[model samples]
Target chain A: GESVGLHLPTLSVQEGDNSIINCAYSNSASDYFIWYKQESGKGPQFIIDIRSNMDKRQGQRVTVLLNKTVKHLSLQIAATQPGDSAVYFCAENAGSYIPTFGRGTSLIVHP
Target chain B: EAGVAQSPRYKIIEKRQSVAFWCNPISGHATLYWYQQILGQGPKLLIQFQNNGVVDDSQLPKDRFSAERLKGVDSTLKIQPAKLEDSAVYLCASSLVASGNGGEQFFGPGTRLTVL
Candidate 1:
């Protein structure tokens, strides 16, 4: 069965520190990956995305790294802030642009 | 622009009961998606629609769950004889199209359903 999973269910970080959340995917043919952030009572919002053609992509204060060989994806947040506390979900495009999301990783940033 | 709109921010029902949720996607968005999100888990795709047509419903539990997007603008998801396991957040999202970039979805504040 095709599935996506996270290495950790929760990640806590201190203010101004860097945080890393990891995801493992089972589909090698998966071509696109995305990171979404969901705040309490809000829907998930797009953070960053990386295509299989690229190994890394960066956004305002976040970066997404894709390792096709290992079927792993990681999201790194620099200078974590209290406002960054939320659940982060990693989605993989299995086929036909249908994205399958993994169990989310709760990121708690302490200020 | 206004984000996706969902009605009845929260609903509480008992097992064997019925409930319906409504959604209005962003203007001009051709793709609409419904998802179920359990606590501590990611959103699971229940169905996907493209302009009033069903694009995908592979994960939908047809015996109890049904959805429609008749006008290509608004959609309704109905669940009959809901079960306790059906307690979860119902999220509605919209995208311009699935052709490029997986259509970067824009989501609405989800409707939380509690089945006791």
Candidate 2:
């Protein structure tokens, strides 16, 4: 079946450094993608999203890049902070609008 | 606006017991979804409703899990005779329109279930 997956299970970064999380999806038909940040004991929160038609989209302090050719997605965080530490997940939506999520990558920021 | 709301932040029960979780989506939202998040994994869609109607539930374990939305508003999900594997977090979300149209979804705090 079609699924989304992360390249790493966990990533550690300095507080002031930048962070990049990567994801790969199998469904070529998927048209929209979203990135979510999940804190401990909380539901996943929407961070940013990009459609298949666009290669990249920028948010307040985050950016999402989609590569249709490689079926890859990435989220970049500028100036990682302690509060930014959490599990980040990537989801892909096909025609049904029901999103399929990746296993998730834990972002650990060290001060 | 107030975000999605869910009750019973945590629950613990033995195998074979029954449990139910409630969810209230954002007002005026037409689409609602239920997802299960296991430890160290992402949330998985269990079912979706489009204004009191079922849009998809292919991943829901019908034999053990059931859900319903009344009057196209509040919704509830029930699990009967729960198993140890059922221990996870249940998340409810809502969107202004059908997700297929690319509507952004807001999520609730989620209910954590621990089946012994």
Candidate 3:
């Protein structure tokens, strides 16, 4: 079965520190990946995305890295803030317009 | 621009009952999607629609869940004879189109369904 998964279920970091979240996909054909931040009582919000053709992409204060060989993806947030505390999800797309999401990683930023 | 809109922010029903959720996507978005988010898990795609036409419903539990988008605008999702396991948050999202790189989706506040 095709699936997207995360390397960590939860991560706690001190405020102002950098945070990294990792994900792995079983399907090598997956070409697009996206990171989403979800707050409690709300819907998931798009953070950033990376196409398979590219190895890295940066947004606001975040960076997404794609390693096609290992079928791995990572998201790095610089200067993590308490506001960054949320459940992070990674989704994979394989030419299909609909992407599949992995189990989210809960990030708790301490003040 | 207004984000996606969902009605009945919270719903409570007994098992074997029926409930319906409504969603109004951003004004001009041509694509709409419905997802189910279980506790401690990520949102799972239930259905995808492209301008009133269903693009995908592979993950939807057809036996009890049904959805439709009419006039290529507002949409509704209905669950008949809801089960206890059906307790979850139902999220609605919309995108500009299926083409190009800017097909980013915007989500609504979602309707939390609690099955008793």
Q: By DockQ, who's the top model here? A: 2
The digit string of per-residue lDDT tens for model 2 on B21-94 reads 99999999999999999988899999999999999999999999999998999999999989999999999999
What would the TM-score be for candidate 2 when compared with the true structure?
Answer: 0.98
Fnat of each prediction, in sequence: 0.68, 0.83, 0.62
Report residue B37 deviation for candidate 1 (angstroms).
0.6
RMSD of 3: 1.1
Candidate 3: TM-score of chain A is 0.98
TM-score, one value per model: 0.98, 0.98, 0.98
Q: lDDT (CA) for every model shown?
A: 0.93, 0.95, 0.94
Runs with alpha carbons beyond 4 Å of true place in candidate 1: none
Candidate 3 on A1-111: residue-level lDDT in tens?
A: 989999899999999999999999998878888999999999999999988999999999999999999999999999999999999999988887778899999999999
Per lDDT, what order, best first? 2, 3, 1
Tens digit per residue, CA lDDT, model 1, B1-116 = 89999988999999999999999999999999999999888999999999999988999999999999999999999999899999999999999987236589999999999999
| Candidate 2 chain B lowest-lDDT run of ten | B97-106
Best by lDDT: 2
- Model 1, residue B13: C-alpha shift (Å): 0.8
